[model samples]
Target: MAYRTWQCENCGFLYEEEFGLPLEGISPGTRWEDIPDDFVCPTCGFAKSQFSMIEI
Candidate 1:
């Protein structure tokens, strides 16, 4: 499956599925759909819902 990148609408934080946030406890290749619903943006504290699918 093609990996996708998501960006936080609030802070421009990019979440690349190809390089999951290891510091955030997210393993590499972790899909956006697999992230917890309550996960917040590390940069802005925005809710996951605030992210939008973006092309890299």
Candidate 2:
């Protein structure tokens, strides 16, 4: 599956779907939109609303 990447608009933190956050219980290949809304930026405390699809 082709995974996409997202960037935190608040902090420029990148969340790559190919390398899911194990600490957050998100397995690899998880989609950006599939991530729960409660999930916050690891670097900044911004919510999912602050993230945008990014081309890497």
Candidate 3:
């Protein structure tokens, strides 16, 4: 199945649903919206709301 991608607005961090961040404890196939609000960008500490969904 195809996965959705999200990009951080402040630091340009890319979050792909198909390949969840194992280091961060987020499992694969987890949707962008399913992530907790308190989850920050691993790269720049940006808030979850700062992430925008991408087509590809």
Candidate 4:
């Protein structure tokens, strides 16, 4: 299993998810790759590029 750290592009909010948090927000059966590009940051509205992969 690979855990990744994702940061919000706008507010820089950091969140760690194993399978991956849902683009619509933390929910059941959420995959990182499944997240939509338009997914806005909970803290700030930013695109996926704003987020980067981090070593856990």
Per-residue CA lDDT of candidate 2, range 1-56, in tens? 68889999988999999998888899988888788989999998899998998899
Clashing pairs in 4: none
Clash tally, candidates in order: 0, 0, 0, 0
Assess the local accuracy of residue 40 in candidate 2 as a C-alpha lDDT between 0 and 100. Answer: 95
Best by lDDT: 1
The candidate maximizing TM-score is: 1
TM-scores for candidates 1 onward, in order:
0.97, 0.88, 0.89, 0.60
In TM-score terms, candidate 1 sits at 0.97
For model 1, how does the per-residue alpha-carbon lDDT over 1-56 read when each residue is reduced to its tens digit? Answer: 99999999998999999999999999999999999999999999999999999988
Residues 1-56, candidate 4: write the lDDT tens digits.
55567887567676666534556467644555766767666677777678876664
Model 2 worst lDDT run, 10 consecutive residues: 28-37
lDDT of 4: 0.65
How many residue-pair clashes does candidate 1 contain?
A: 0
lDDT of each candidate versus the true structure: 0.97, 0.90, 0.90, 0.65
Pairs clashing within candidate 1: none
lDDT digits (tens) for residues 1-56 of candidate 3 = 57989999998889999998989999988988788889999999989988898776
